[model samples]
Structure formats: structure tokens, C-alpha cells
Target: MLRAAVIGAGHIAKQHLAAIDAAPGVEAVGVCDLSAALAELTAERFGVTAWETDFRRLLADCRPDAVHITTPAATHLAIAKECLEAGSHVFVEKPIATSLEDLERLAAVAESSGRWLVEDHNYLFNDDVQQLLRLHREGRFGDVLHVEVQVDLPLFAPGSRFVDRHAPHPAMREPLGAVSDFLTHLSYLANAFVGPIRSASCQCRRDSPVATGAISEFKALVDAAFGTALLGVSTGGEIDRFRIRVDGSRLSAEVNLFEVGAILTRTRGGPKPLIPIRNMVGRGFSELRNARRSLSRKLSGGPGPYEGLWRLVAEFYARCDRGEAPPVSLDAIREVGRWVDVITHAACDNATVSERQPEAVGP
Candidate 1:
């Protein structure tokens, strides 16, 4: 069995630990956190024998085949490089790296080390996402013409939407806040169906009260193989919804990533009365499929529903087991990173443009 270690003990780290335990042919060798208490607690909960506050010691002692870096975006590069140099494969949380330079640098080290460096772009592995891709492949949605992604999550309680003193979300005050952390998911999902982006335009605003000087709402326009799509994100939304709509040549589809639901409709180029009947039939089939997936997740005793954390971890270890290249390509990582840079530049005022451009960086 391959051994695995988790470096960060944040909210996301728990998911990694659990997935590691459930993954076949993989064992949770140890866990490391900045806080000794947290590290010990997590290790005990997972029945792991090793736990330490010092990451350097954890790597030297545990000698794991793979390391999952679930720390914040800021510390990913350093920890990942250390893990790679220590002769361990790396399973990292996303956005890969915040800046283009850091991503390129990490890609460089990871390559030279001859190790697998995979990112937890987990939602793309969800059953809902897979079904959507299947529909496109089956010619149900002939030629994705255009698509739009709308992600809405409430950042605070109903009474307090915004405040300068007490920011609702920890990310509000951070450099890009949710823009960098959450939007990356949407961007990658867009790539799954929309194809590679050509150009992008971004707009951000403070939609709530108080003078926090944080951007709580934003939108991006991307020109891509699916033509163009409007990407929307609102932290002040009343409803917590993660949905993307694709307008294709033959049919249109609305998919909810969080709930693992999808609805496809064939509207245009069809007779007036027949369209309603067709949509009714389509909705029935969609509901049936969603119900089956939800039930399967509940009984499978795997990681939680539609999260796909378990599936992603399993795939990463499988690659490590076979001594193969990373499942996700570095080119795809660079494309997503490049678009994020462009959007953040266009959103913020007086943002410094990067002198170095993104290139193909991998082993």
C-alpha cells in the first residue's frame, strides 16, 4: 500500500484526510499542522499513528509516497516544493498557485523531481459534471455555442451583509478574496465544457453596505471555444447556489454543481407544440438520473455526495502507484492560471501587469 501525508489542518484538510483513509491501496501515514493540538486531534480522529507540528520532520520521518497540501493558497508553493524534494508525490488544493511566477516555479521543481503533482479540481470529477460531458459527447448538445456560470453563496448572516471591522468571510480582506479561491472552480469547469479561453473582461463591485473596501460581487466575460460565457459570482446572495448554463447548437443545459443536478432542453429548431413535450420528457429523465446518483452516493460509503474528494485522491494515488505523469496536464493548469491573472488585473485598479508570460512548463 502507498503511504500518504497531509500538511495542512484547515477546513479542507479534514476532507483530504478522510479521502486518504478511504482510498484503496493508500494509507494515511501522518498529518502535520502548525498547531500541535490540531495535528494530534486530526491524527487521532483518523487513527493515524504519526502526527507532528513540524512539516520538515513529518516528511523525513513518515517517508510517504504522496503528500496532500491543503494549506492556504499563500503557503502551497513552499510546502509543495519541500514535499517534492523529499521524494514524495504532491496532491495540492487548487488555484495551483496564486501568481503566474509561483505556478511556473512549482511546475519547474515538480517536473525535475520526477513526481506527480495533482490539483484537487474535485468538482470536475462529480457525477453531475461527468453526465453533462456525456450528453455533449452523445451529440445531445451539438456544438457548445455559448455558456454562462452563476455561483451565488451568502458570505454573512442576513442582518450583516458587509462591515469594515468584522468581515463576514475571511477571504473578504485577503488580496483577491473569493475571487481567487472560489472563482477558480468556475474557471476550470468552464474549461471542461467551454474549451480554452481566448480573451477575458472583468468587473467587480462592493454590492453591500459598510466600507470594508472588499469586492463582494463580480462578473467575467470570456471568449472561448464555446463562443462566450458570462461568469457571475455574488457572496451576498440570499440563496447559496452553484449553477452553470450551457447554450449549445442543438440543445441547452442548466447544471448545478453543488446539488449534482442537471436539466437539458432542446428549444430552437423544433416545432412549437412539440418543444414543450420534449422538455417535459427531458426533465423527467434528468430527475431520474439525479436521484440515482444521489442514492448511489449515499449507499456507496465513499466520500460525501458530489464532492468527489475521494475520487480525486484515489486517482492521484493510482497514478503514483503506476509511476505515471499527472492526470491533469500542466498546459491546462497554465491556461487556467493565465486567465485568473488577466481577470484579477482587469478587476482591481492599478494592478501591475506581469512582465513574464505563461508558457508550457512541465517535465
Candidate 2:
């Protein structure tokens, strides 16, 4: 079995921990966090005897085949480099690095050290996203032309951590606030469908008092490969929602990433009567099917919402066992980071970001 360890004890890290537990042919050998109590608790719960309050000690003790860096986005580059130097493949959680330059440096380390640096674009493994890929590859959505994405969060949700003023939220303290944490996800999704972003104009604003100078809403207009893309993010919604729409010369499709379903419509000169049938077959069917399965999974003891996380973790270990490169190329990850950095700079009223937190970027 491939040996693995996680180095964070946050909510998201918990997801990774569970995924590692469920992953076949992989043993969670250790866990570490800055918080001693938290690290010990997590280790004990996972049946991992090697728990350390200090990350350096954890590395020295376990030296697992892979180190899952589930820490904050800002710490990714530095922690990942250390793991690589210590002779471990690194699986980092998203927002690879806060800036383009930092991302490039990590790329260099990966090249020089010959260790894989994989970022968790976990959403890419979602069933809906997988289906979207199939449709694209099968030419179901012929000649993709344009794209639209919407990411909304319900900040007012009764127990949301977003409203916790005392909590050290990575998004709230990052260079671009919420934008820093979210743009990577959106940018990568754009690249997956529309290709490299050639040019873009992005805007952000604080829409609520709880935002603490962090932007609560953002919008971007981007010129991508096939055509253009309009992307948006906002808070204080009644419910969380994430949706992406791809318009092609032959057909158009929409996927609700949050709802875990997709819908499609043919645009390439279909008869009026056939349009309704196509809607029933494509749009209505996916929603009904996904909803039923989602409910069933929740009812069962399966990895409920973050099934994609489990799949990605399992695949990362599988690749490690096979001595193969990561599924997402380092170049592709760098390109996505570049897109996010450019968009963040543009959205911040062209004010040069002269500095980031020392811990946020790698050397």
C-alpha cells in the first residue's frame, strides 16, 4: 500500500482525511498540524500513530510516499517544496499559489527535484464534469463557442463559518480576499472548456458588512479560445450554487456543479417539436437521475458530497504507485494560476500588488 499523510486540520482537510481513509491500496500513515490537540485528535481518530505538532517532525518521522498538503493556499508552495525535497510526492489543495511567480517557482522545484506536485482540482472529477467531458469529446457539443459560469455562496446560512469574525479564514486574509480562493476554481474550469484566456476585465466589490474589506461579489469578462466567457461570484445568497454553461455551434449545455446535474439543448437547426423532446431527454433526465442518486448516497454510508475528492486522491495514489505523472500537468496548473493572478490585478483597480503575506508565496 502507498503511504500517505495529511498536514492540515481544517474543515477541508477533514474531507481529505476521510478520502484517504476510503482510498484503496493507501495507508494514512501520519497527520500533523500546528495545533497539537487537533493533530493528535485527528491522528487518533484515523488510527494513525504518527502524529506530530510540528510538520518538520512529521516529515522526518513518517516520510510517507505522498504528503497531502491540505493547509491554507498561501502555504502551498513552501510546504510542497519541503515535501518534495524530503522525497515525497505532494498533493496540494487548490489555489496552487497566491501569485503567478510563486506558481512558476513551484513548477521549477517539481522539475528539478523530479517529484510530482499535484493540485486538487477535485471538482474536475465530479460526475457532472465527467459527463461534460464525455459530451465534448464525443462531439455532442460541437465546435464550442462561448462559456458562462456562476459561483454563489450563502453567507447568511445559519451556521456558516464565513460569518465567523474570529476565525482565520484564508479567503478573508489573502491578497484578493474571496477572489483569491475562488478565482482558481473558475479559471481552471474556463481553461478546461474554453482554453487559455487571452484577455480579461474583472471587477469586485464589497456587498456586505460581514465581508471585512474582502470582496463579496465579483464579475469578469474574458476572451478565451473558442469565444468569450462571463464569470461571476457573490455571497449572501439563500442557497449555495455553482453553474457553468457552454455554448457550442451545434449544441449548448449547462451543469450545476453544486446540484450535481447537467442539462443540454441542441442549437444546430433542430425542428421545433424535437427541441422539447431533446430538453426532456437531456435537461430533465439528468436532474432527476442525479438528485435520486445523490439522495441515496447521502442515505447510505458512502462518501457523500466530496466523492470527487476521494476519486482524485485515489487516482493520485494510483499514479504514484505506477510511477506516472499527475493527471493535471504542471504547465496547465501554472497557466490557471497566471489567469487568476492577471484577473485579480485587473479587478483591484490596477493597484499593483506589491506584497503578499510572507507565508503566502514560496521562495
Candidate 3:
């Protein structure tokens, strides 16, 4: 079994631990966090042998074959680099690195060290989203004309370290914002289904305390090689929702993340068109409505969707082991890094004007 250590015992770290436990041929050997107490707690809870406040100590002592970096956005680059240097494959959380420069450096380290580096854009692991990608690739939707994506979720509570109260720390604020945090999933989805983006433009606004006047709503128009797409992202709402609509000549497919299912509608150039395909994957929370449903069945069930993500990571490492090509190449990650830079810069500039213009508006 591949021994893995997780860095950062934060909220998302637990989810990573659960996914790691679910993945076959992998074991959690150690855990590290800035808070020694939290690290100890996580290690004890997960039945790990090692725990430490300093990740370097864990790297040297525990000597895990792989490391999962789930720390804050600002610390991703340094931690990932350290892990790579220590001869461990690294799995980093989303928004891979704060800057393109750091991203390039980490890529170089991974290349030189012959270690696998995988970025966790977990949305790609969602079975429904994967099915959508497959159907789009199979041409079930016909020639794609345009794509639209919408994502909105609640933010961390006030005074949380996640929400910066003072001047924006570019690294922390840029990637953690609604546009980068949530909409990047759509961006990745768009790249997966549509072609490479040629050019893009966006307009955004920040309206609430959750985001602390950070950009909460963002709308973007992207020019893809195949066609164009419109992306809309928002937070500061009571609901957590996501939707993707792909329009085509013969049919259309709509996937609702909140509903956990997809619907395909077909049409012909005649009266009374037909709705051909309607497939539902998960229970859609219908089981939650019934008190009789067993919690064990609901929780411990279903082919774990994150298995594919683990497989992807494992394939990356196997490639490294065999001197084969990395599954998600550095070139691809660099391209992603470039797009993230553009989007982050655009959002920052827009937020500055939006903040100032409001005071300039009236008295």
C-alpha cells in the first residue's frame, strides 16, 4: 500500500482523509498541521502513527510516499515544493498556486524530482459532471453552440481567518474568492467540454459580509476554440446551487448540482417535439425524506465517486514510477495557471473600482 501523509488538519482536511481512506492501495500514515493539538487529534482519530506541527518533521520522520497539502491558499506553493523535494508525490488543493511564477517553480521541482504533483479540483470527480463530460464528448448533444454555468454557495462565517479584514492579501483573497473558489470549477468544466479559451472578459461585484465586500458575483464571456461560453458565479445567498446547460441543434443537456441529476431534452423541426432522455443517478435526497431509511446505508453506500480522483492521482504516481508521462502534465497545469492569473487580475481590478465608485456615487 502507498503510504500518504496529509498536511493541514482544517475543515477540508477531514474530507481528504475520508476520501483517502476510501481509496484502495492507499493508507494515511501521518498528518501535520500548524496547530500541534489539532494534528494530534486528527492523527489519533484516523489511527495514524505520526503527527506534527511542522510538515518537514513529518516528511523526515514518517517518510510518507505521498503528501496531501490541504492548507490555506497562501501556503500551498511552499508546502508543495517541500514535499516534492522530500521525494513524495504531492496532491495539492485547488487554485494550485497563488501566482504563475510559483506554479512554474513547483512544476519544475516536480519535473526534476521525478515526483507526481496533482491538483485537486474535486468537482471533476463528481460522477454527474463526469457523465456530462462523457455525453458531450460522445456527441450526444450534437454540435455545441454555447455553454452556461452557474454556481453559488455560502461563505465562511465572519471573523474567520479565511475572510481577510484588512487590505487584500492578493494570494489569499484572489484564489479564495467566489470567482476563483467556485467558478474555477466551471472554468475547468468548460475546458473539459469546450475547447481551449482564446480570450475572455468579466464583470463582478461584492455585496455582503460573508465575502467582506469581496467579489461575490462574477459574469464572464469566454471565447473558446470550438465556440463561446458564458459563466456566472455568485455567493451571499441562502442556497448552494450549481447548474450547467449545454445547447445544441438536436438536443440539450442540463445538469443541476443541487438536484444531483441531469435532464436531456430533444427537439426536431416539427410540432410537439419529444423529450427523449431523462436519467437520474443518485437518490436525490428522496431517501432523506423517509425516516425509515438507514443512515449506514445512506452514508456507507454508492460506488464512491472520488475513486476516480484517487485513480487519477495513482495513475500520475504510477507514471512517475515507470518513467512514463504524467497523467496531468505540467504543461496542462501551466495553462490552467495562466488562465487563473488572468481571471484573478481581472477580478482584483474590478473589485477596486467597484469599492471606490460606491463612495463616489452619492452622499
Evaluated with TM-score, which candidate comes out highest? 2
Runs with alpha carbons beyond 4 Å of true place in candidate 1 = 158-170, 267-272, 284-302, 349-356, 359-363
User: Over the stretch 6-45, how does candidate 1's per-residue lDDT look in tens digits?
Assistant: 9988778889888888789999989999999999999999
Can you give the lDDT of residue 351 in candidate 2?
Answer: 42
Compute each candidate's TM-score over C-alphas. 0.88, 0.91, 0.80
Model 1 compared with the native: what TM-score?
A: 0.88
Residues 36-67 of candidate 2: C-alpha lDDT, one tens digit per residue: 89998988888887888777888899979899
Per-residue C-alpha lDDT of model 3 across residues 25-58, encoded as one tens digit per residue: 7789999998989999998988888899999999
Q: Which clashing pairs does model 2 show?
A: none
Each model's lDDT: 0.77, 0.79, 0.69
Provide backbone clash counts, one per model: 0, 0, 0
Clashing pairs in 1: none
The local distance difference test score of model 1 is 0.77
lDDT ranking from best to worst? 2, 1, 3
Model 2 worst lDDT window (10 residues): 352-361
